[model samples]
Every structure is written in structure tokens, then in C-alpha cells.
Target: MSFKSLCVAFGLTLSLAACAVGNTVDYRDVVPPLGVSGSKSVAVEAVDQRPYVLAGDNTPQWVGMVRGGFGNPFGVHTVSGAPLSSDLTQSIIDSLKQGGVKAVPATARMATDRTLLVTIKNWKSDSMVTTSIYIDAEAEVRDQAGTVLARNSVQERVVNEGEVAVLPPGKLERAKAVFRRLMDQLLNSSIRDALR
Candidate 1:
């Protein structure tokens, strides 16, 4: 094959790889250990309201874009998979369990004393030479009667401009750290007070 032809083939291969992967981030991969336990019964739910990946409808890669994308010329945005709300919901569950909270999914049939509703106002990670993760969310503690007991908002913007975030899993690990901070911020602040 001609040298020019080889170059084209290589580019095609990289783009194809990007598409095949769909540039997604699984929230389950970012759950952190809370090291605290609670017997408090609560149901959790999350709804994503960002407009991005695939026109921001409902699908994976909602975590935001860390790097390359298939047909996306600007860049690729990471996804959560299928639907974002589900991913956030599960992530919250894992985080609560790590804290030893008797947490259950809002959609489940288990009995719960209170329900915590989380609206993902915005969650994204964009990186090229450097990576930055910005997460904004609102959490509400409600009684079994659906009365709001406490409301809290979490917004954090962290920029990892170090050489590490420019690497492979480095970017991913950076995002995980943000996820941990996000949960940590919530549980320690309003959530903790409400639970206590």
C-alpha cells in the first residue's frame, strides 16, 4: 500500500476504535468508600438534566467527555450507559452502602423511611492536555409522605492540570476522585445533618 493510503487507514482505525468504545464512563467505577455506617432507611433516586452526549436525550456517556469521540469532531463526551438517571441512582446506592446507610433504589419495592432525590444539574469531565471535572447537583431529603425535609446543593469544579491527568486511566482516576468528593461533600454537609 502507498504511504498515504497507510496513513488514512491508521486514522480510520483510531476513529473506529473511538466509536466502538462510545467514550463512556460508568458511575459504578467511581464509587468511594465512606467508612461510615448507618441503619437509617432511605430510598435514593437521581435524574440527569444535562444536554450534551447524543443531544442529551437519554443514554450512556453522560459522565462527560474525557477524550476522543467517533463522529464528534469537537470531542467525545463520556456516557453513563442506557440512561443517566439509573447510573446516578446506582452510584448513590453504592456510596450510601459504603457509609453503612440502609439505602434502596427509589424504584424498588423495599420499605423505606425517607427518600432522597438527587437531580444532576450538571456533571462533566473534559480533557485534552489537561483534564477538568465540574459537577453540580441538588439533593433533597423527604419524608415518607413526600414532604421535603432538607434541601442541599453541591457544586464543585476541579482542574487537574498535572501531567498525570494527561495519561490514560489518569483522566479516569481524576474523574473518580471528583465523584468521591461529590459524595463526600454531600454526605458530610446537609445529608449528615439530616440523617443525624
Candidate 2:
């Protein structure tokens, strides 16, 4: 092929590539539904850090969603194959910190002065992309040697703005937000109940 033709083809390819790159979409940056408030009434204490449990294991627990099936298209699922568990855990930890509650570490020095066990039972979103996340969280706080300080279960459902009341496209995000809000509530409630 002639050099002139080769250069022209190369330039056209580069231009097309540039345009494609520029038009790339980023769903991650999509604006989530509003009305997510992380306010709570707990005076988080800077005290002993405790370990948490998930599914009967004394490990770093994750705020998992149950998953919306069939009609629940825009439900809580991974973006590009990344599981939402990690994000959920981080959100919970952040909310706990904001609420002033001391979190138990996953491992190391102390023998877990306290243990917080959590579980997410069911999660779903609707057809019009409206998301509704429901979580059945069980917080079982125990001292060293497995002595239960407090054991409580909390069920919270958070709804977001979308086309239908079913679930939203940002279902996973809504679940995480609601989990944070509910964590604060649960932490405060558990602490208060334990004290009483």
C-alpha cells in the first residue's frame, strides 16, 4: 500500500479510537438516589475493639444483599463482575466510625473482647429501577469466653427513588446506604440495651 494511504488509514483509526474513548460511559459515577441520611442517636465510644462474625464464623463480616431475581432486573448485582460484599462491609465500617462506635478488628492482639455477628437475609429492586433493600441483621455482642453481652436482631428496609416502587438500577448502592443507616441504629440500640 502507498505511504499516503497508510497514513490516512492510521489517522482515521486514531480518530475513531479517540471518539470511542471519549464516549465511554461510567455507570459507577451515576448519581444515586437522594434521601439517604446517615444520622443516628448513638454516642460511639472509643473503647475496646471487638471482632465480628458472619454466618457463624468469627471473621470480618460483609453487608451482603440477597439478590433480586427475574422481574427484579436492576437489582443489587455486581458491576462488571465485582461483588458488592466488599463495598457493603466498608460502608458499614464507615458508618460505625461516624456514629462513634468502636469496631472489633478481624485479627491480632486482643482475644476479641466483643463479637458482632451480622447477616443479610434478602435484597431486591423493582422493574422501573426503583430499589428496595431489606436486611435482617443479627448483632450478637459477646465478651471474651463467649459470654453474651447483648443479642438483638434488626430488620430494616430502605427504598429509593426510581420508576417503579419495585427496585432501582442502583439497588446495591441503596442497600449499602441503608445498611449504614441501620448499622448506626443497631449499634446504638444494642449498646443501650446492653447497658440496661
Candidate 3:
């Protein structure tokens, strides 16, 4: 075999190996700190997620994968993992409870006067040597009569410090950080203000 041909084979092997790494998607839960106090009782309604965010099987769709370094400038890869809207809804309810608000599951009756509705506008990640996860959501508060009381939009960006292929766990950690931050902002500020 020629020297150039051998080198080409070796490069192809390496690229395939890197791409194979971190193909499985994992989920992390968000837990908020306790301290802030509020005087509102709210029932968390089902969260609405954009259609393109999920796969046909109902799992979160994998965002496109990105390569590290500058060798293949035009290469795009697929990433695994996404948080379900139900999971996010639960997280928000938990955070609300921690923040001294009476939060309950949404029901047709025997509930609070106010209902919280959340819409996930964007939830995506950009992979590379360093990965950035972006989350954007909007929340609204309404009375039993369907009158909109208050609404707010929250967006968060988090960057992880590692290559996606080398450290797949770091990507999940960064995603958790972004989720936590978004929940914190919503529970402490946005939702609190809306209730007031």
C-alpha cells in the first residue's frame, strides 16, 4: 500500500471513532435552591413544546452534531438527547414549591384560581470543541376564567468546557446548568412578578 493511502485510511478510522463516541442521550433533573418567598397558589398546566423538537417515537430529537477544530469546516453531525416538555413542566412546579409558592398539578377542579402555562420556544445545543446550549421559554399566568394575568419570556445560554466526542458527560452537565438557570430565573423573578 502507498504511504499516502495508509495515512488516508488512518484518518478515516479516527474520524469514525470520534463520531461514534457519545451517541446515547441522557437526561438530568433540575433542582432549585430554597429561600425566596411568595404568596401565590398556582396550578401548573401542561407545557407546550414545538413539534420539530421531538422525534416520531416521541423522544427529544437529536440536535445536529458539530466537530471540534478546523479540519472539516462544513461537516455537521447529529447529537443525542433532549428534555421532554413534561419533564420541564415538573421541574418548574418543583421550583415553584421551593420558592414558597403553593404549586399543584393542573386539574379541572379543586384547585387554585391561577394557572401557569409554559411554552418552550427553543431548546438546542451547538457542539464543537466548546458546546453552547440555548434555552428559550415563555410563561403565562391566568385566572380560572382564562384571563391572562401576566407573562414573561426567559432565555439562557450555557457553554461547556470540553469536546463533545471526548467528554459527552460535559455536554449533559452544561445542559443541566442551562436548565437550572432558566428555572431559577422563572421561579424567582418571572413567575413571582406575574403572581404579584
Candidate 4:
């Protein structure tokens, strides 16, 4: 190619690199599991414990960078449109209620309610020509004065490759599947009973 052609190619690459690679999709609204009877009263508090501080935050959000690859990790990130902690907290409460449990946010007072602390331990993706999403969370129930009653954790992963992985629907949509799986396990696990 001519010198002018090379210069134009380099400029084009630079402009593409300058484009935003951040993703923003809310990770809520999983299908609630069938409500169970004789569930217990509990207050829920969710926390995001992932240790990475990513780039770009124009709104209240939760973000995790996609890992694996050289330099900036494909310059992509997985983000949620709302603060993850509160979103999980509310989702947990709603799920518990739909499951026939008396559930509320930690801020709500109760006569004799167990406190459920749910934590986001990991939320990440790996990609090259493929994208693999992973997520895990732990839920612990404690009595008044913080005596642990029960604890359980759940994790999920999904891999996408070939044509679909690099095509439309984006990172956020791919990640939502893993998040849904994570929530489903929480609803049907021993942790839900322990909260009672």
C-alpha cells in the first residue's frame, strides 16, 4: 500500500480504539422460583465484593471488566445499569416473597427476623474469539447479634464462540443468562430455608 494508505489505516484504528467499550445492562428480573410454604421471616442486604475498579461511570452502576487477552482485555466491560448491591437486595426480597417468605430490606425492622447477607463474590467474562461469562454469590443467614445460622453459595458460567460470540446482542445480554442462573440457585437452595 502507499504511504497515504498506511496513514489512513492507522488513523482509523485509533478512532475505533477511542470509542467506548463499556457495557450497561441491568441484572435483575430473573424468574422467581415456585413459592414454598413455611418459609421464614428475613431481612436482606446485598454487597458487591468484587475487587476491581473499572473505567468510565456516567451513571449509578455496577461494573466488571472482561478478563483474558492482552492489553485492556479487549477493551470491553460488563456493566449493570443500577448499583448492584441494592439491586440484588431488592431482587432477593422479591424472590423470597414470591417464594412465600416474609422478606424485607435490611433497613426494615422486624420483631424476630433473621438477617440475610448476600454477597457478589465474582462476576467476570473471558474472551478471545469467544466469550465466557462467570458469576457467583454467597448468602448467609444470621440471627440477632450476628450468630450465623446457615450459609450457601452459587455460581454459573456460560461460553459463547464462533459467529454468535462476536456478533450482535452484545456483552450485557450474554451476561444476563449467567446472572439468571445465579439467582435461580439462590431461590431454591438451603440458604432460603436457613433465613427462616
Candidate 5:
């Protein structure tokens, strides 16, 4: 092959290799093992996820190493995935239902005495040598009269190395695990307290 053709072929191979490096997994599969068991009906609104940031150019590159460190060696871009708000809301609703709560998706005309609202303040994963994930958010429970019954700020962390290896290997898997843990903490603490 000529010099120009060789250069183009090399570039194409690198591009393809990069594309194959990142894994895009679904958020729906990251279900936690614990949930509240109750007959109380609850409505969960689509969570507000405006503040959440997935992998980005500014995110440290070491995080990509946890997933085999190939496609995005620099970790300059995140593997594309689902919207956080939709996935998180659905996951919460599913978990509540599994726990025996009559959980339903919130709607404008729906009649429910209790409503749950969540706003994600931060969601991030990092690695110095090993991966760690952190989440911060606010949650509120209110009654039909719009009376706030309980409110709290929630934060959780999972370390992916040594004895604290709570997360899995892929970025999508790590995200799923983080979300599951975060929701578990939210339900067991703030939301449970509010319902009482």
C-alpha cells in the first residue's frame, strides 16, 4: 500500500478499536436487594437529574482503566447510555413495588396521599488506581396537601478495590451498582422515615 493509504488504514483501525472499548449497559438491570415492605401506596415522580453528570471530558481517565482501559484510554468521553432521570425513577418504582408497596408512577391527575420527589445533585465515579463512585441528592416526601413530611440530603460511596470491591468491572455495571446502592440508602433512610 502507498504511504497515504497506510496512514488512512491505521487511523481507521484505531477509530474502530476505540469504539469497541467502551461498554454501554442498561440502567434497568441495577436492582438492589433490599426494599421496604408495606401496603401503603406511593407515587414516584420522574426524578430531576439535571445536575447529574455522566462520564465527560473532565472526568479523570483512571476511571476507564477499571473497564479494561482500551477504547477511551484517556477517558475523555463517556460511553453513551440512558437518561438518568427516567431510569432512576423506574428503578425506584420497581423496587418499591417489589417491597410490597403499591408504588405507581406519578401523574398530574393521579390521586395519592403520599408523593416522593428526588433531585440528583451529583453523581460521579473516579479512580486514583482503583475505582470509587459517589452520589449526592435530595429527597422529599409530601402529602396531598403539599405538606412536607420528610426531607433529607442523601450521599453514598462505593469503593471498587481491595476489600471494598462493591462495584463490578464495566462502567455501565459500576453505574448500575452505584444507583442501586444510592436508591437503597434513600429508601431505608429518608423515604422510610418520612412514611412513618
Candidate 6:
């Protein structure tokens, strides 16, 4: 190859290397297993018609590697190709109902016993050029009046060195599953707290 072409290739390689070296998923702290029983019930408002933030919504690339593979590796957002807010929200609502909860209709104009406002502050993912995947999320819940009820920012790390699934099924599916599971835990905790 021409000298100029070689120089360009070297520069690109260095740039990519820099990006790779910059961010690494860190889940060193031991994360205790999530022990949530669906027995408890919380008075949750009907699923809001508004879009539910997709798993890894507004997530960063670095966070992706910790949870699962990025939906769209080339896209700006790591989990960009994941379901939309509405899809995710509906999924959660349905899961909650099945698990055990009096779900209100999203269109109900009247406010119910309790309303929950969830804000997903950050979601991120990461993976090497060849293989490996993961995802993370930071979320919070508030009451109808906007009082912070509880906040949690945790990263789910699924290190894929070779051929062992951190998730039950696989990484991508596992990420989605984890998202739903996290929501379940949130509901469980919220209900337990509200009842108290």
C-alpha cells in the first residue's frame, strides 16, 4: 500500500484502539442475588399510556458491555434497536398484572390510589469489536406529587469471554429479560414500601 494510505490506516487503527481502551465495564463489587417474591401486592396506577422507556433507553456504549450486546453496534445509541417506550411499558404492565396487581387503564382520567413516575436516567452497553456484551441502567421512582420514593443505579454485567451465557438464554434476550426483571423488583419493592 502507498505510504499515505498506510499512514491513514495506522491513524484509524490508533483511534479505534483509543476508544476501546477508554471504556471498560467494571462490575467488580459482588452483586447480591435479587430475591423478590411476587406474593406482595402494590397499588400501582394502570400502565401509563405514555411510552415506557425502552431497556437501556438513552444508555451509553460503555454500559452496554456490562449488561449485553449493543442492539445496533454501529448506531449512535447502544440499544437503539431495542423496543420503543410503548412496547416496553406495555410489557411491564402486562407482567405486573400476571404477577398480581390491580392494573388501572392507562386512559383513566381520574387519579388512583397511588401513581408512580419512573425516570431512567442512564443506560449504557459495551462489547468488543469481535465478541462480548453487557448493559446497565440507573433509575428512580417518585410519587404522584413528585416525591422521590426510591432510587437505584445498578449495572448488570454479562461477561462473554467465550461461550458461557450470563443470561438465562443469551445476552440480547437476557438484557431484555433483565430489564423486565428489574421492573418487577421495582414494583415489588415499591409495593412493600407503600404498604408500610
lDDT for every model?
Answer: 0.66, 0.41, 0.59, 0.61, 0.59, 0.39
* Candidate 6 TM-score to native: 0.43
lDDT of 5: 0.59
- Predicted model with the maximum lDDT: 1
- How would you encode candidate 3's per-residue C-alpha lDDT over 93-177 as one tens digit per residue? 6766777778776754556867888787666565556777776778788987888877878787777765535554455456556
**Model 6 misplaced regions, further than 4 Å:** 1-83, 105-108, 124-149, 155-158, 164-170, 180-192
Sort all candidates by TM-score, best to worst: 1, 4, 3, 5, 2, 6
Per-residue lDDT for 65-180 in model 1, tens only? 54443333233334433466776678778777877788888889677877888887777776655667888888888877778888888888888777432443566666767777
User: How far off is residue 150 in model 4, in Å?
Assistant: 1.8
Ranking by lDDT: 1, 4, 3, 5, 2, 6
Q: Give all TM-scores, in the order shown.
A: 0.71, 0.45, 0.64, 0.68, 0.63, 0.43
Q: Which pairs in model 4 have colliding backbones?
A: 35-99
lDDT of 3: 0.59
Question: How does residue 89 of candidate 2 score in lDDT?
Answer: 40
Taking the tens digit of each residue's C-alpha lDDT, what string does model 4 give over 1-196? 9999999988855543343244445555643553544556778888777655332332225444443323254334324445767777877777778757887888776654688887876665554445677777787889877889788787877776563334323644665666677667765557656664
Candidate 5 wrongly placed segments (more than 4 Å): 1-20, 29-34, 52-81, 127-129, 156-158, 162-175
Model 4 lowest lDDT segment of ten: 53-62
Write the residue-wise lDDT of candidate 2 on 68-113 in tens digits. Answer: 3222221123343332334344444445444455543333344444
Runs of candidate 4 exceeding 4 Å displacement? 1-22, 53-60, 65-80, 109-112, 126-128, 155-158, 163-171, 186-188
lDDT of candidate 1 at residue 55, scale 0 to 100: 69
Tell me the deviation in Å of residue 189 in model 4. Answer: 2.7
**What's the true lDDT of residue 124 in model 1?**
71
Clashes of 1: 14
